[model samples]
Target: SGGPNYKVALGRRDGLSYATEEAVLSFLPSPTSNVTALIDVFTELDLTTKDLVTLSGAHTIGIAHCSSFENRLFPTQDSTLDPIFAENLYLTCPVINISSTTVIDIRTPNTFDNKYYVDLLHREGLFTSDQGLYEDFRTKPFVIIFALCQHLFFENFVYSMTKMGQLSVLTGSQGEIRRNCSALNSNLSWYAVDGDGHDGKVF
Candidate 1:
């Protein structure tokens, strides 16, 4: 898979039920998660450190809410952040209950590239998990590799994403395709098995 020329395997069925935010909170790494905490969460998804670093390149495009990185600026700016980067963030983010937006990638935020790795190296990463990749030796090498070679990052990204796409796969007749993308096709009770072998259901 490369660029928009790739096709994901089809006929995949949606989960019977969606996870509540509280239920999902435990599984997701916090914005301030350390390398260890991040590994624990990604490990549950069968993604390795290399995968974590490479996959994080997706942050290259998109905007983040201020709440996602405000802690790094307010109270006390994170020492890991470059002084100029932190100052810019403080100007962009307010400490109170307000919504704000900031680019995820400091370099070419409009493009999908391996610049995220470089951003991490420069202490320009938006989240702690991102900066952690550069700080931790285990994942740092991969970040460096990805930053130096976009081709390698692209290849690895395709493979990791392919693996991720297959993690919770179910075969024919296991579940029904949703008639609507936003809502379940039916309200009647339905069930499906997850990647971790847990049975999921819709109320």
Candidate 2:
């Protein structure tokens, strides 16, 4: 992976509890979102338009399930998609092929560089939300800049990511510093629950 390494801001505390599925979904922008919708979502999160374009570079190295973008393929192929790219996607994901997956960045699929912006420039961006950034005037300039220079993308990505990490931060006594991230502090029990709904000592 040609991914850049940056020092992450540490000392961030975790929330005392997890967010509900509805809450999580509410906070996340949908893949089918247009540029305006994406910008609005990020703006609500206190991120700038530049940050929106920069952070989306993360798409440079991931796979997306067909269901996430099949709408763009079916009902009618998205006109903005490159003809060759759309044909390839049709082969990878036909109707009712929900389990099929495709790489986000067709060019340099495994690399974490600026190829995602390159893909956008060529109209090969896999998601509407992604390609829209290139067509939207507000974000198109940054897209062009990053596509022309990988160094700037990496630098801005780092800054935007750090800034994003600071949002809604939990301070002293607001959240916990979990000893183990997977299990909640309250779930670290020495006993198990019996079928009768009683706590039974594991010993």
lDDT of each: 0.80, 0.89
Tell me the TM-score of model 1.
Answer: 0.82
Residues 125-171, candidate 2, lDDT per residue (tens digit)? Answer: 99989999998999999999999999999999989988988899888
RMSD (CA, Å), candidate 2 to true, equals 5.3
How well is each residue in 1-203 modelled by candidate 1, as lDDT tens digits?
A: 12323567776787767768898787667878889888888898988988888778888888998888777777888899999988888777857445978898988888888888889889999998889889998898999899899889888988888888888776666766665556665553464445786556645
Off by over 4 Å in 1: 1-4, 94-96, 187-203
Specify the highest-TM-score model's number: 2
Using lDDT as the measure, the top candidate is 2
Clashes of 1: 0
Q: Please identify model 2 stretches exceeding 4 Å from their true place.
A: 188-203
Candidate 1's C-alpha lDDT? 0.80
